[model samples]
Target: MRIALFNDYRIGSVNGSRVADITEVVDTRWHGTPYVINEFIAHWDQINPSISAAMDRADTHELAGVRLLPPVPRPGQILAAPANYRAHVSEMTGSRHRPANAQALLSPREVGFFVKSPGSVSGPSDAIELPPIPGRSFHHEVELGVVIGKPARGISRERAREHIFGYLVLLDMTMRTDGEHQEERTMRKSFETFTPIGPFLVTADEIADPTALRLRLWVNDELRQDADTADLIVGVDELIERASAVVTLQPGDIYATGTPDGVGPVEAGDTVRAGIDGLGEMSIPVTERGW
Candidate 1:
């Protein structure tokens, strides 16, 4: 099932061209703040049956009528893998914008993972706002966002699939820092409106093999990034096992499996669209901060 959160966090189960309103059947306690989707994911074994039943009798809305929010809004931890793709590793390593004082770039297995502030997440329809800081260029990293369902710590890669809830399209917008006062690595990617995710979260059951899926991104009308997940240096399951060792992976926790090569700067008035097979696609506008 494609689970989605629409306007005001109303939950729904998506069908082709329509959504069945399942929010009424959802437990009211998970309605606001901290980890609303946690209960929905952690209890999915119990909730899935109810949601299916509810969808049969619930009101349906045209998919285009409602605004789609991030499938896991306000996730507990927004973990992002840096340089998970060998092509991206080489691209950034050779880029003119590569930080002068930065350390050597390597695959995620060696570098570990970094966190993007959960506050940076926004819906598919929202605009990507560039901050007022001058002389910084914002680059787009289109990636696969993995949502965890069950809690697990120190689990093996073989057990990783059991903990997964779903997957979604995510754009990790990065601000390239320059000048004498450089922005920290985490800070550079944690700016508000930097993480745009969704359209819908395609449940793990819908996809038989995550690594076989392909990801593609476009700026305006031109294609930028196009790669297959088969090329990932640190695949999804291993990422979970590695990351879980450091921090207990909780329900609704998201791990951005990192982007492939072709990341470049975006400017105001440009539109960004990204798609992953099975998980769906999202297009968001880019604009100067209106503050």
Candidate 2:
């Protein structure tokens, strides 16, 4: 079942044109102080049955009219992979004098992940606020976002799937610099409005294989990125296992599997549309940061 937060942070199950409201079910079941995304994810298993029953109710709302919020608005942590795709690494590192050699690939073990600030998270329909810094190159990295369902620490790769709640299409908005000794990678990616996630969170059961999905991104109708998860140097399972070994993975934490090749810069007024094969799509507008 596809779950979403729509119009005023209401919880619902999404179909093509309609959404079934399950807010009441969630409230009555969880009895939490505030009905936030974290609470929703924490009680997902308990409320799943109720949400399923509410799907057939007659008071569904039009999906298009509702404002879609990030599936997990305040994810405990936003862990992201960089150069996880061999082609992406080559594209970023390839020089005018020497072309990248695919044979010399660094495993996820070698190139560990970075944590994007949770404050960077924004809804899919939200505008990507371009930093006011002039001459800074801003790029879009479309990735598959993995939502964790339960708390886990040092989980085995074999059981990694058990911790995943579902998946969503994520746009890792970045700012590139030319200086040799630049700011830390995490700092570059932690700007507010840098991470755009959602459209919908498709439950794990719906995705037969997470590693075999197609990802694509378009900037103002221009296709800038197109690659399959199959091209990932380190797949989802290993990412989860490896990440958990460092820190305890909590419910609502998002693991953004790295982007594929075709990364490019985006300017103000450009609209970026990105998607994963079955998870769904997200279209985000771009705007200059008004300080």
Candidate 3:
């Protein structure tokens, strides 16, 4: 089922252009925090039955009419892969997008998974605000986001899929750093609204093969990033295994499987759109400074 968190943190099951409210079926108390999404996912097997039974009788609304929030409102951690795509690595190694006087690029095999501040995350419809950093080139990177459904540490690649809850379209917006003052990637990527995710989360059961999905991104209606997850230097299972070894993976934790090539800068007033097959898409506007 396509699960979404819409206006006022109401949980819904999305069907086509409409959504049916399933919030009542959930048994967990939100405690006044949208972190309820985490509990909902963690107990999905137990909670899904009630939600399914209620779908037919629940109140429905147009999907476009409701304001959407990040599927995982406050993830415990936002672990991401860097240079995980073969083309992305090669491009940064030699392409003009490479930072000036930078060392040769490294792949995930060498660098491993990195963490970004969870505060960087925002809803799909939220405008991406650029932090005040003069002479900075902010780039857009569209990637597949893997939401963890269960806790796992030292998880094996063979058992990786078992812990996954779903997938979403995640844009890893970045601020390019020069060689003179090389900055940490996490800091460069952790700015507010830097990680805009979710049109809705497509449950893992609905996706046959995550690697087979195609990802596409457009800036102001012009296509820029286009590729398949097949090109990832490390696939989903391995990413889970590798990441779990470093830190405990919990429900609502997101693993941003790095982006494919064609990354470029975005300035104020530009709108960015990205989508993945099977999963949904989102459009967010870019602005300078904070809200």
Query: Distance (Å) between predicted and true CA of 171, model 3?
Result: 0.4
lDDT by residue (tens digit), candidate 2, 16-130: 8888877776555433232466677787788777766666663688998888888788888899887798888777666321223322446577867888999999988789999
Which tens-of-lDDT digit does each residue in 15-86 have in candidate 3? 989999888766547833687788789888888778768887899999889989998889998999988887
Query: For candidate 3, what is the TM-score?
Result: 0.95
Best-matching candidate per TM-score: 1
Q: Which stretches of candidate 3 lie over 4 Å from their true place?
A: 95-103
Tens digits of per-residue lDDT for model 1, 174-235: 98855545678789998889999998988999999999999999999799999999999999
Tell me the TM-score of each prediction against the true structure.
0.96, 0.92, 0.95
- Candidate number that wins on lDDT, 2 or 3: 3
Q: Evaluate residue 54 in candidate 1 and report its C-alpha lDDT on the 0 to 100 scale.
A: 84
Q: Which model is ahead, 1 or 2, in terms of lDDT?
A: 1
Error of model 1, residue 222, in angstroms = 0.4
lDDT of each: 0.88, 0.83, 0.88
Q: What's the number of clashes in each of the models?
A: 0, 0, 0
